[model samples]
Target: MEYQYPFSYDWTTQEIIDVIKFFEAVETVYEKGMNRDEFMTFYRRFKEIVPSKAEEKKYCNEFADSSGYSPYHVVKKMKESNPGDFVKMES
Candidate 1:
């Protein structure tokens, strides 16, 4: 990846790490595939850090702009899939 992960100055060190992990999971979905449960774990933690939909959109947009990976689409696929399904995307 040529770009840095989007992050907020207000986040703590651990929060930043968790947010990065969430982005990484998104990356995994596009590059290969990720387990629904594993991706959900990251997504849940991401929600904890960014509870507001507006704020979440801001972060996701920034990440997508830099990385060309859409977190929104990944989350959408995850929500649409059943348990034990893999989340995958093609860009």
Candidate 2:
């Protein structure tokens, strides 16, 4: 299956930090203003691990509620993993 936030290899640390900050800010805002039930929904949606079906459903549910407002969305810089040993990207 195609990754929703498909990893990119060229991203700098600064870029990733910037995204993290933004996500945190959104979490803070929603936590302050939204009700407990909605906030719980938001929190669950935020902590979703990569490549999980449960996470995918939370994403769809959040989209329906806000029409496209989520804080957990991050562009991960993922590399291939080897089951038995280290995997390296082509250089």
Candidate 3:
């Protein structure tokens, strides 16, 4: 909960905020539950900011190292879920 999020210096302030929001939504998926639509909204914006697969993996791996939550898992679950479903990770 007290870890720094992975971010790029090249990004604008709003882009950084959007990236953090997406990471927080990933956290929410593990901590409680998030609506699929809402989580995807965050993910979509995140993709806009981090378009490269390598870059996304780097950021997500850093986040997992710091926060102990896996963005990969959340996205995997998201892929398996329907629009109205709630995406949650079991502890």
Candidate 4:
């Protein structure tokens, strides 16, 4: 069985990077275009959100552009939170 959130198991550096990239993408979308300032802000916040360097990757493989975004896994995560923010709100 997999460990659930608020109780994440463990994380690795690669996982952290993957998530960071994900956020960067999201920021791009959120901004409605490429905004370096907004991206840096999101990136900084994302870094703060991750508990540690040995961090677990949430949204590990959900990016449509990336091959790693596993559909099953991404769907599961989508089912959890982010009720409307992802769609209702652009980016």
RMSD of each: 0.7, 16.9, 0.6, 12.1
Residue 15 lDDT, candidate 2, scale 0-100: 45
Clashes of 2: 0
Model 3: weakest 10-residue lDDT segment is 82-91
lDDT computed for candidate 4:
0.41
Best by TM-score: 3
Q: Can you write out model 2's per-residue Cα lDDT over 1-91, one digit (the tens) per residue? A: 1123322244456544443443443444444432334333334443433246664555444542453334333111111222232212121
Which candidate would rank higher by lDDT, 2 or 3?
3
Per-residue lDDT of candidate 4, residues 1-91 (tens digit):
1221122235466555645564545534434543334334444555565645444243433333353223233333334534233421232
For 1-91, candidate 3 gives per-residue lDDT tens digits of 5999999999999999999999999999999999999999999999999999999999999999999999999998998999999878986
Ten consecutive residues with minimal summed lDDT in candidate 1? 82-91
Measured against the true structure, the TM-scores of the candidates, in listed sequence, are 0.96, 0.29, 0.97, 0.31
Arranged by TM-score, best first: 3, 1, 4, 2
User: On a 0 to 1 TM-score scale, where does candidate 2 land against the true structure?
Assistant: 0.29
Better of 2 and 3 by TM-score: 3
Instruction: Give the alpha-carbon lDDT of every model.
Output: 0.94, 0.36, 0.95, 0.41
Error of 4 at 83 (Å): 33
Q: Please, what's the RMSD in Å of model 4?
A: 12.1
Candidate 1, residues 1-91, lDDT tens digits: the string is: 7989988899999999999999999999999999999999999999999999999999999999999999999999999999899768988
TM-score winner between candidates 3 and 4: 3
| Inter-residue clash pairs, candidate 1 | none
